[model samples]
Target: MIKVIIIGSGNVAQHLIAAFQDSQNLGSEIELVQVFSRQTTNLSHLLDYDKITDDWNTLAEADLYIIAVSDDAIADVSSQLPFKNRLVVHTSGSVSLNALDDNNRKGVFYPLQTFSKNKAVDFKTIPICLESENATDFQLLDKVAKAISDKVSAINSEQRKALHVAAVFVNNFVNHLYEIGSEICQEHQVPFEILKPLIAETADKIMVLTPEEAQTGPAKRNDTATIEAHEAFLSNENYLTIYKTLTQSIQHNGKKL
Candidate 1:
């Protein structure tokens, strides 16, 4: 059996734990030996055969150690490990595999999806990015990744970093726009719930349509009158500035299409 151990107990840790529990590909062949974290409260909801610990010594018994801690803590947490034979991996997109010491075999198993502790995540649909120093390690990583997801890819460290940046652009920045939209709705006395359908449709259309093709708004239509009207409605200087900049960007980019 491939004895697996998980480090840290944050949002990503919950998702990883659920995936490891639901993994049918490995069946009984793989076992989740233990979970390590500073707090035992995070593991309270988890009720099964596995053990939880605040100590790092438990890592010595596992075959694979997965560091699911924050990006900044990854290197610090990894450097404290006492084992060498176990394959040590991190589930971070922004961090590099070399963050772990060269004394142990290292790899990355980054899941390309946002994880929230309160919001449930669909593990099977999320893409898993796998990378390792050698073919054998990569195969092992691939096996673990594929067991939880069908969308597994062999990405190098640089590509993974690039993807993480792109993800921030698409998910984080876009979500900020949604927050702004909600605030605008509040100020205008417009129902924020009314934007839900449009939001859902915007995401749905992208599944079968390119973002460029699906782009539609005053900017896309070059409706300067509507744009100016919206800008006039925005009392906030920053919002107006963003609206003008984005409109200009869209207009300039739209001409290429």
Candidate 2:
């Protein structure tokens, strides 16, 4: 059995712990033996106290140690680990594998998704991106990933970095635009719920059609009059700027296509 210990008690860590525990329950060869948290209480909801540790010294030996800490803390945390020559990895898309301390074998185990502590996600559908210097370690990571996820890829650090930036544009930036839309609705006394179906259809469309093909807006059609009207309707200087910027971007992209 491949024993694994995860460090950190944040969103990604909690989700992974749940996924690994579920795998263990289903008799998968991978076992989640322990979790390291600076405060044991942080992970109490997920695992028994015995399996969670606040002290690093008490960490049990495991075949793999997954560091799920914030990007800034990864190097420091890995440097502090008491053991050496073991397989260690971080779940970061932008951070390079070399950022990990060389005391242990290095790898990346990035799960490309937006995670909130309140929302539960199905691990089987989450694509896991992995990188490692050692082919043997890569195989072990692949096995571990396959135990929970149906989609897994061997991604190098450079490629992973590019993927992360694209993710921010698609997930983070797009979500902010949704917030703007909701704000616009609230300002006009319109129910934000009215836009839910449109939001769902917009997301579902990309599954079948390319984003460019799915595009259907005044900007896409170069309807200059409607675009100017939308810009004029936005009294908020920031929103108005954003509207003009996005409209121009859409028109530029359409022109290129």
Candidate 3:
């Protein structure tokens, strides 16, 4: 059995806990030995209270220690681990693998998916980006990743960093645009649900088609009148700047298509 301990109690950690629990049904030998949280109460709802602890010294011996803490806290948390020369990995996309303490074998087990505390995600669909300092450690992470997710890939640190940047643009920035659209709908007393089908269609289109091929908009078509109208309609200076910049990018990039 692959004994595992998860450190931290955030969205990724909670989701991982649930994923590992479900993995047992799939014939996985992974075991959830313990979970570390600064306040055990935070994770008591998701994990057995007995399996959760606040004291780092109380961490059980395990084959793998997965640190799912924030980017800034990963180094501090890994450095404080009592044991050394054990396989330890962090669940971060942007943070480098070297951030972990050298005393332990370091790896990155980044799940390329957005996590929400309330929302339930299917781990099978999420891509697990695995990286390790050595081939042996990579094999272990690959086994554990495949046990939970059908999509697993070995990505180097530089490639992972590039993927993280692209993810921020596609996921985080696009979500912010959705928020802006919602605000616009509220201002006009229009139901945002009206845009649901359009949103769904836009997302679905990219599944088979390249993003460039799927692109369609006033900017892409070089409809300066429509673009200008949109820029004029925005009251916020920040939104106007963003609108113009994106429009310019679309036009410039669309020329190649």
Candidate 4:
């Protein structure tokens, strides 16, 4: 059995705890022995009070220690681990393997999905990005990852960093665009629900078609009059600048065709 200790009570850490807890069906291949949180109350709702501790010295001896802390705190937290030469990994996309204290066997087990405390996610669908400083530790991480997720890949720190940046563009930036769209709808007294199907279809289309191939808009068609009207219609200077920039990008991309 892989005895695991999770260090954090945030969204990702909570989700991982749930995933490992449910993995008991796999003949208890993965076990959540303990969880460490500075504010033990934060994890009390998820784990038994006995299983949660604020003291680092009380951390149990586990096969792996997964630090799911924030990016800035990873180094400090890992450095504080009392033991050494254990398989210690962090759940971060941007932070490198070097962030962990070298006193332990370092690795990364980054899940390539956005996590929310209220939203329930299927662990099997989330791709687990695994990396290790050595071959033995990599195999161990792979085994643990496979127990909870169906999709797992060996991704280096550099590749993981690139993927993190791309995720910001696709998830974070695209969500911001949705916010702007909702704002525009509110300004015009139009129900934002009216755009739901369009948004769904746009997302579905990209599954089978390249984003460039799926591109459709006044900008893609080089409709200068329509573009100018949109620019003028956007009363907000910031919105107008965004509209012009996107339109130019679409036109430029279309030129390559």
- Candidate 4: segments with Cα more than 4 A from true spot: 26-28
Error of 4 at 160 (Å): 0.6
Q: lDDT of all predictions, in order shown?
A: 0.86, 0.94, 0.92, 0.92
By TM-score rank, best first, the candidates go: 2, 4, 3, 1
Q: In model 4, how large is the Cα lDDT of residue 119?
A: 79
Candidate 2: count the clashes. 0
Task: Predict model 4's lDDT versus the native.
Answer: 0.92
Query: Model 1 segments beyond 4 Å from truth?
Result: 24-28, 48-50
RMSD of each: 1.7, 0.8, 1.3, 1.1
lDDT of 4 by residue, 61-114 (tens): 999999999999999999999998999999999999998999999999999999
**Which has the higher TM-score value, candidate number 1 or candidate number 2?**
2
Q: Which stretches of candidate 3 lie over 4 Å from their true place?
A: none
Q: Give the per-residue lDDT digits (tens) of candidate 2, residues 102-195.
A: 9999999999989998899999999999999989999999999999899999999889989999999999999999999999999999999999
Residue pairs of candidate 2 with colliding backbone atoms: none
For candidate 1, the TM-score is 0.94
Model 2 / residue 109 / CA error / Å:
0.6
The most accurate candidate by lDDT is 2
Better of 1 and 2 by lDDT: 2
